[model samples]
Target: MAVLLVGTVVVLPSPQSTLAAWTATEYGRGSLQAGTVNPPTNLQCSAGVLTPPTFTWTLPAAGGLTRTGFTWSLSGGFTGGGTLGATATSVTVPGGLLGIGSGTFRLVANGPGGWTSTPVTGTLGMLTAILYSCSVP
Candidate 1:
């Protein structure tokens, strides 16, 4: 039930369904850092008026797991792909992805995981949602 917080990085506590097990992990976690990565915030398009707009965002405050990639998507005409690497803070997607209308975009973080369904402290792994939402005009 304890949130795995390290400095500015904040990993989410276990979901309601996983409480009992997570509670124990919290106590034994020590340095394991087993938990969901908190979402990044403040997604923006620095140059929306131009083709191949550049997207940017503020990374999560805290999560011990290193982000291996980033996935982006939206409800607009765009079908985004995971073209961004772990360290990429900004990227220029294809032209016409961002139409004139406004819509919300989503981005999620990915990392190595031993468990596909869960993130354990055993090694670098697990990612479902470190997915953050953002909007642009």
Candidate 2:
């Protein structure tokens, strides 16, 4: 409201804002080829569950175009595993160096700048055969 004081016109200042606006620049982005590449799906464990564990899975059709390598690991039963080239679709974790009973397995796709795909995991049952399938069959 405005007021006229003794022939003089007076006006009030509007309220001040408490917040301020700022600007920033984007640095990067993340991707998984629409969930088709990293942490390959359709994981399958061969009939060999005794000596060591051999696991395989499917990757995106363009997997070789992006992925550099694959990392596999076995936990729960013991603690052992290794990395393989992108050309290979399966991994055979060495005997936990010290293992027993059932266990768990994990896999991931290796990428640049500490980039890794979502992990694929599964339970590992007890060994059923003396001759492992990863190395022999």
Candidate 3:
């Protein structure tokens, strides 16, 4: 009589398989999980109605994985500053481009994964116009 011993072999998942499973869970066939970015806060303008004033604000945190860029505008109108990468937390508005008088500047951050938050509005003072003029006879 001959006796044979059988051992059980266990197979571990490959890195690719593990990654694929993670991908399927995180980003299934339906859609990828994305995050919305918070609007910039604590807006501030330098010099008050000064030309080439610097605008600063606290950087917003991403609601999910990551945020892509920030869009700046004036009174809901897009400014020439264009889209800024996530690294940027502030931007300077040229006096000429800002025009004259008082206006509201808005900012909203967006993520590449399809997320855009409500825009935050901030007021800026411009010294462009003369408040009053006097004439002597």
Model number with the top lDDT: 2
lDDT of 1: 0.48
Q: Candidate 2 residues 1-137, lDDT tens each? A: 99876776789999998777667766777865533345676787764535565687887356433787888876774677788887778876665343346667778887665678888787665544353433121
Candidate 1 lDDT, tens digit per residue, 1-137?
Answer: 88986677678987575345433443343455576644455556543223344567676557546666666655444454454666666655554444444444556766667212121110011111222222353
TM-score of 2: 0.57
At residue 37, give the lDDT of candidate 2: 40
After superposition, which runs of candidate 3 have C-alpha atoms over 4 Å from their true positions? 1-34, 48-50, 76-81, 129-137
Ranking by TM-score: 3, 2, 1
CA displacement after TM-score superposition, residue 103 of candidate 3 (Å): 1.4
lDDT, candidate 2, equals 0.66
lDDT of 3 by residue, 1-137 (tens): 99999999999976663333333445345655545567766666555423355667787754554667888776523245567888787777656555445666667887665677678766664554422111111
Regions more than 4 Å wrong, model 1: 1-33, 96-103, 114-137
TM per candidate: 0.47, 0.57, 0.58
Off by over 4 Å in 2: 1-37, 49-51, 61-65, 96-98, 127-137
Q: Point out the worst 10-residue segment of candidate 3 by lDDT.
A: 128-137
Taken over the whole model, the C-alpha lDDT of each candidate is 0.48, 0.66, 0.61
